[model samples]
Target: MPIDPQAARLLAMLGAARPTDWPGVSAAARRDGFAALMRMAGTPPAVASVSDVRIAGAAGPLPARLYAPRDGTAPGLVYFHGGGLVAGDLDTHDALCRALAAGSDCRVLSVGYRLAPEHPFPAAAEDAVAAAGDALGRAAEFGLDPARVAVGGDSAGGTLATLAAGALRTRVALQLLLCPALDAAPDTESRRLFARGHLLDAAMMARDLADCAPGALDLADPRLSPLRDPDLAGRPPALIHTAEFDPLRDEGALYAERLAAAGVPVRHRCHPGMIHHFYGLTGLVPAARAALADIAAELGARLAMG
Candidate 1:
């Protein structure tokens, strides 16, 4: 599929903000730049209430935000934000969470997990698993139904979600992933086809891995690349979305196929002509708003069936 015109324009606009020496840019600088771009999410859709909260992490208190559309106990989601495992925070994805919580009728707990080059691999993953467990154990305090809880995220956060749900399969009600980087290094056609032009280029991804895992970390380890897991049986039901022009597209598709083959209930979609992170660019890609709504509706419907 050809790139969406809106997405193309967005890429063009972003091209100006990209550092000329991307490979040489420090992780701190990269994170700051990414934060600046995410600010374009603009004013978020209002939820009934929003507030800062602290949650249990693998090692300590994890900073987080709570977005609730109701005053009483409700379905809940433990969410992580995407920034290549080194960037992003609760505020960067505030708008997206508001929409999900309001539209999906779920209380969303947006987690600010530990980042790379500081805490490194397994740290964020461990925090993800812990946050989900903590949310479930203390659901009442967050005004959530302990029985109806999902784990989800976009991009790198999606990666964390996978690890968390896998570690807590029987407990998590659902898994929501958007344009997730499923593998550290996958040799899929999409990886080659869209390697250069998309917002998340290969070089950027490589840098993310370098900083994310650093020394002695095996990229092929299922802990880092869940797709490599030989068995997908009993994993939580999943709603996986990928972008047509994303380097990570094929890996998501393959995972969906494998999960189904393993008897796991799952649904996957590749947004035609869309690029990575398209769902979060609704302000620019108007059509992407409908995609997000579809997610909200699906999320609500699936959990209701529980």
Candidate 2:
């Protein structure tokens, strides 16, 4: 199938707006640019309520935002935003959180984990673990059901979520991964086929990985790349979402396969004609909206099973 017309238009618009010299810019500049680009994607749908709070992290007090569809206890999801673990913040993903909370009828705790280049690898991963612990411990205060809690994220955030799930296996209900970057050393055919022109290019991905892990850590380490984990039998059920035109597409699908093979129930969807980060562009693309709805429905159903 060909690329969706709406998605193709979005890609072209983004290409025209994005600076051609973005790759040569400093990390801080690139981060700001990326945030600005996301802000212009579309207007976020209104949710019941959104509040700011702080959660204890491994390093310090981590900033977080809670989005709820209504005022009451409900299933909760500890969500981490995507920016290659280098750029995104709570504000960057506020809209998506709102939509998820509204659509899924689940409270979403969006964590502001420490970014890379400043904190580095295992730092964000550690914070994810700490935040989930805090969220679970304080589930009552947040009006969440501890037994129905789930962990999720997109891109690098997805990597952190997977790590947290493995460490907190049997505790979490499900893992929702959207265009997750699971393989640190991705050598899939999709990576080669969509290496450039897509929203996330090969050069940008390499830079993000380097920034996150500046030290001499093995890329194949399961902590850095969950796909390398030899044992995934006890992890929670997973819902993996991929994009047809994404460089990370193959890896996300592969992770789903591995999870199912390991006896972990999995639901994987590869959206035809979509690209990386389309989850945040629901207002611009009908397909994106449909995908978000499906995610919300799945979350609601899975969490209700508790």
TM-score of 1: 0.97
- What C-alpha root-mean-square deviation, in Å, does candidate 2 show against the real structure? 1.3
Each model's Cα RMSD: 1.1, 1.3
Per-candidate total of colliding backbone pairs = 0, 0
lDDT of 2 by residue, 1-306 (tens): 787788888788877766566447578987996787567447777878889999979989999999988888999999999998889899989888888888888999999999988999889999999999899989998889999999999998899899889888878988999999998887899999998788888888888888889878899998789998999999999999999999999999999999999999999999998999889877788888888888888898889888
Candidate 1 lDDT over 205-264, as tens digits, reads 888888889887778888789899888899999999999989889999998999999999
Residue pair clashes in candidate 1: none
Winning candidate number (TM-score): 1
Residue pairs clashing, model 2: none
lDDT for model 1: 0.88
Please state the error at residue 284 of candidate 1 in Å.
1.2
Q: Candidate 2: lDDT over CA atoms? A: 0.89
Q: Which residue ranges in model 2 land beyond 4 Å of their true spot? A: 19-23
